[model samples]
Target: MKAVQVSGYGGLEKLELVETPVPKPEKGEVLVKVKACAINNTEIWMREGAYGTGSNSGWRPEGIKFPRIPGSDITGEIVQCGSEEDRLLIGKDVVLFPFTSSGERGNEHIAEDMSFIGSEYDGGYAEYVVWPADLCFDMPLKTYSDSAAFSVSGLTAWHMARQVDIQPGETVMVTGANGGVGSLNIQIASKVFGAKVIAITGDLKNEEQLKALGAAEVLSYKSTRLQEEILECNGGPVDTVLDVVGDALLAVSLKVLKKGGKFCTSGSAGGQITQLDLRILYLKHITMYGSVLGTRAEFKELLQEVSNGKIQPVIDKFFPLEKAREAQDYFKQHGKTGKVILLPKTGDDLQI
Candidate 1:
């Protein structure tokens, strides 16, 4: 099998495309022939040791194992099942759940033993991958590339919306509104949750597209009067703020929120650390939540919504597996809307 392996935490040099032996499924697992895998900031940050330093930089406290395959948002077809009872799954198209956890029901994402697919186990950046049979769900969209776009970013966005408890007709502000998670946040908060979304992005060119995705208004982050613009456009302070750009918009997010409003954050793409005055939290009575991936229940709901045509996949570009380094670089560039995909099969063999 051909795969891309991260030898260690570093730059693009860490990702190497190489030929390796195909892995067989263990008990309760199944082998999937890779179709499409989307690129995300999580895997890129993991490779750069952004979460921490030394042996604690990955999804787990033990850090990433050397030469690990790196992709989580995956869509593939089942080629083999580990047990006779699961043999019926073979030949079915599926999308991976992206994580494994022992936490009970609603508390799965916060469990002490939660393990991510690309980080804790070998992932779909290869021709074949083995995952627990129960974790694989039927693809929500007909195309592999469309189904692959959501597993990680969409799940994170869904969890954030749930954390903030967005309500119908409420004004919700979504920062970094052009990226994968940010774009999905706009759709889920507005289309699915029935909220009015104020989409904020660095580039104003995406304003039309963002509004098409259910945003009530689109504003550029470069505006000097951003806080005022948000308040005026919504007719007052927003009811909630869903942020992915951290330090860059933290102060403005708190300022434009209605008193006692909620703030939910899932990413820190712009900047990680920022100075905060305690008055912003106490004086305004703001409630904040730090969210990550969601539970099985949320994943199921997300899939259903996509299947129902309520949520749409936004794809920016596609690359062959061998050009992972270039793909990761393109993914990080500003102003690209939606997911960047990698296909293991080359030369028009796959319908990306």
Candidate 2:
């Protein structure tokens, strides 16, 4: 089988296309013939070695050994099943749940031992990959690329919205609202839950598109007096803020929230380290949540929404598996609205 391997932490030069043996499914696992996988900020952060302690050097998780295949948003068909009871799943198209459990599946909040797909072990970026059957859920979408596109990004956005529990008629502000997760957050918050959505972005070109996606207002992140603009445009402070861009913006976002407002963050796209005013936290009695991946229950709800066509995957670009490096570069440079997809080349896998 052919796979894209990140031999070490570095730039795009670290990604290598190589021939490897086909993996056999172990007990409780299944072998998926990957048809499509989406690239995400997680892959870029891991490639640049940004997830660990230091800015330039650190580990992602316990199993982030080098020479790893990196891609987690996977959608494929099960060609082989390890358990006899799971034999019925053969030929089923499924998207991976992404998280490695800590025994308790339902309570992901307390499951601190949880790990992820691309970081914890070899992931999709291959012709075929093996995973525990429990993590695979059926994807009823028309194409593999479409299913893969929504897996991780949609799940993260949904989980963040749930964390804040956006109620109907409530106001929520989504930062970086033009990116994959942020764009989806706009849709889920306003379209699904009937919340008044306020989208924040550095790109003004997305204003009309975002409003069409259900944003009540679009504020510029580059505005000199952004805090005032948000307050003025929304007529008051927002009830919740869904922020993915951290750094100084984190503190500024905190300033724009109404008293007792809820804030939830899942990504740190704009540098991780940032300062916050302790007074702003306590004075307003604000509630903040640091979210990662969603629980199984949230995943199920997201899946149902996807099945019902309530939520749609927005794709920015597509690249062949051989051009994985180029895809990553494009995402870092030009990707803003939605996911970037990678497709396996014809007969790219070795018949070992």
Candidate 3:
């Protein structure tokens, strides 16, 4: 099997493609022949040592082990099962759930024993991967690439919307609206949850496309009067702010929110740290939430929505397994509007 392993937390040099022995499924697990995997900021941040204390970063406190395969949003076909009872899953097209947790139903994402795919276990940046049979759900979209685009980003965006409890007709501001998670947030909040979305992106050229995806209005983050513009578009402060570009828009997010408005954040692409005045937090009675990947139940609902054609996949580019480094670099570049996919070239001519 051909796999790309991250030797350590560093730059693109950390990701190396190597030929390794294929892994077999353990009890209750199944082996999947990798078809497609999507690139995300999680893997990029993990490699950059940005998710934890200085010089050591990962999904766990022990830090990531060296030479780990990195990819989570995966779509593939099950080829073998460890347990005889699970053999029915063989030949099934599936999308991985992205993580495992010990917490009870609603609180799974914050469980103490939570382990992420590609972080705690070998992931789909290879020709084959082994995951628990129970964690593999039927692919929502017809093609591997389309189904692979959502596992992580869509889950995170769905959880953010649920955290803020977006209500019908409420105006919600989504920052970094052109990115994968941001774009999905716009769709789920507006199309599914019935909220009016005010999309904030780096480019106005994406305005029409974003509106087609359900955004009520699109504004540029580069605007000097961003706060005023948001207020003007909504006719007042927005009911909620879904922000992924941390420090760059934190102040503006706070200022443009109506009193008692909710705010939810899942990423920090622009900057991480920012200064916030306590007065604004307390005086306005604002509520804030920090979100990440969601639970099994939420994942199921998101999949159903996609399967029902309520939410569409936004794919930006594709690269073969050998181009992992270049793919990661392109994923981080500015102006890209959606998920970047990696094909394992496993002889399955999967199409989007």
> Largest lDDT belongs to which candidate?
1
Off by over 4 Å in 2: 53-63, 346-352
CA-RMSD of model 2: 2.1
Q: Runs in model 1 with CA error above 4 Å?
A: 346-352
Cα displacement (angstroms), candidate 1, residue 310, comes to 0.6
1-352 per-residue lDDT for model 1 (tens digits): 7899999999999999998877888889998999999999999999999999999899899999888999999999998888999999989999999999889999999999999988999998898899999999999999999999899999999999988888898999999999999999999998999999999998998889999999989999999999999989888899999999999999999999989999999999989889999898999999999999998999999999999999999999999999999999999999889999999883234221
* Cα TM-score of candidate 2: 0.94
TM-scores of the candidates in the order shown: 0.97, 0.94, 0.97
Assess candidate 1 and give its TM-score to the true structure.
Answer: 0.97
* Sort by lDDT, top down from the best: 1, 3, 2
Residue 31 shift from truth in candidate 1, angstroms: 0.3
Backbone clashes in model 3, listed as residue pairs: none
lDDT of 1: 0.93
In order, the Cα lDDT scores of the candidates are 0.93, 0.84, 0.92
- The better candidate by lDDT, 1 or 2, is 1
Which runs in model 3 stand beyond 4 Å of their true positions? Answer: 347-352
Consecutive 10-residue window with the lowest summed lDDT within model 2: 54-63
